[model samples]
Target: MSTKFNTFILTALASSSSFGLTPAASALPPVTAISGYSFTRSGMDLNYVAIEFDAAVLPFEVQAFVSKLGGCLAVPENGTDNFNAAISLVLIDTGAPEDNAAWLGIVHTPAGDGELHWSTIEGDSVYFLAFDKGGSSNSPEAPLGVALDAHSQQWFDVTLDDGSSNIRRAVLSFPASMLDCDADMIPDALVLALGLGEDQDGDGRLDWCAPAGDFNGDGIIGAADLSIMLANWGLGGETDLDADGTTGASDLAMLLAGWQQ
Candidate 1:
């Protein structure tokens, strides 16, 4: 995800009540780096990711963050990992840099967590940095080791200095099923469709990044898409472009703004 959004986008978001989350203030920090591991549950292979935001985000921040995504899901002990096309974020893969993906695999987070229907990405820098001290008492990875196992794949693995207090540390765990759109038995991919759907058509490649507000998946925001949104007005689902859980004035405004006409 981008460290920062452009002036116009940020300003517009600031004015809109589209997210419909609490506190009506910014809470979550920008994700700067990450790390990860793998696990199993009821025959399902899950992906786990350790997150390091630019700041020490609080618990409430997690809830607020999901509100931005249009809907929130509960995945018992796993946090909410599914990401729709509500917004953009950073994606990283521990096993393969090329496996780096977008969307939220960050399910139920005690602090940092989600399932991946799909999410969006505005920026990326996929790399692995490991500073494994192997049980050394003074290692920086010690505090963050739970999410960074010895045999796991990861993004960053270096010395966490006084500059790294880890108050910003959290984890993202998700089932491979949520992200294996490519059927590769792994969690990864990128969403170039900044203002569109998540993996539409399921061809992977995020449907090669669908056009803005192409709700019907016909590759454009046309009369049919607008009609669908209007039909669902005051409701939720894809028509709720702003992802506030209900199609209302904000969703209408966004749809109109992105209208192909």
Candidate 2:
């Protein structure tokens, strides 16, 4: 199916209108960086990386994204313990302007044995699969194989050559895409939170590094100043604040705190 069709199906599965369960504004959980991993030489081995998230209700689009990347559950022979593999994330839809579903990006080393995976449906659980040896050259005695489930998220392990082993573990948090704030989701908020633009507040100021809206300096946000931020919003132009994917209350609050004292 086309990316658009896949997104539509995911949206239908999640019941698009039921966004009430998510807070209009909330704090993102501390993101644990994917570690103990490195990219491969040809940039194809998935190894060492791990990703975990809340699976209570999976987002359809996110699930399709993971499925498109192609997941595998690797199993090794008796002696080896570390199993390694990698999946590529090259396809992205980047939905419409007003639609929050289009924002998608992959954040992991693409070449090594470290890999991350998730589903689009909410309420489901997050799964993990890792490998230790994934180079192009394989010994005739290598005992590594993987199994993948397209429907349900399950745990699987891959064995390596040295009699060592690894197990896939599930996580307990929602993916960035599932977060709903000011009509946008986590991806947008993350972009803003990262300070990627010069005019984060969209107030026409080119230098957003000053305290144009950050009131407390603690970095936590409030709504009073954000009330002044609804004027300008979009891409490429100046008036886009908060970078939370749109020019709305959430972005406003982020800029309001940075507003000049």
Off by over 4 Å in 2: 1-163, 166-246
RMSD of 2: 17.9
Q: Rate the local accuracy (lDDT) of all candidates.
A: 0.37, 0.27
| Per-residue alpha-carbon lDDT of candidate 2 for residues 154-216, written as tens digits (9 for 90 to 100) | 223222334342212211112222222222211222223323224555543334243444333
Worst ten in a row by lDDT for model 2: 1-10
- Write down the RMSD of candidate 1 (Cα, Å): 14.2
For this target, which candidate reaches the highest lDDT against the unseen true structure?
1
**42 in model 1: Cα distance from truth in Å?**
18
TM-score of model number 2: 0.22
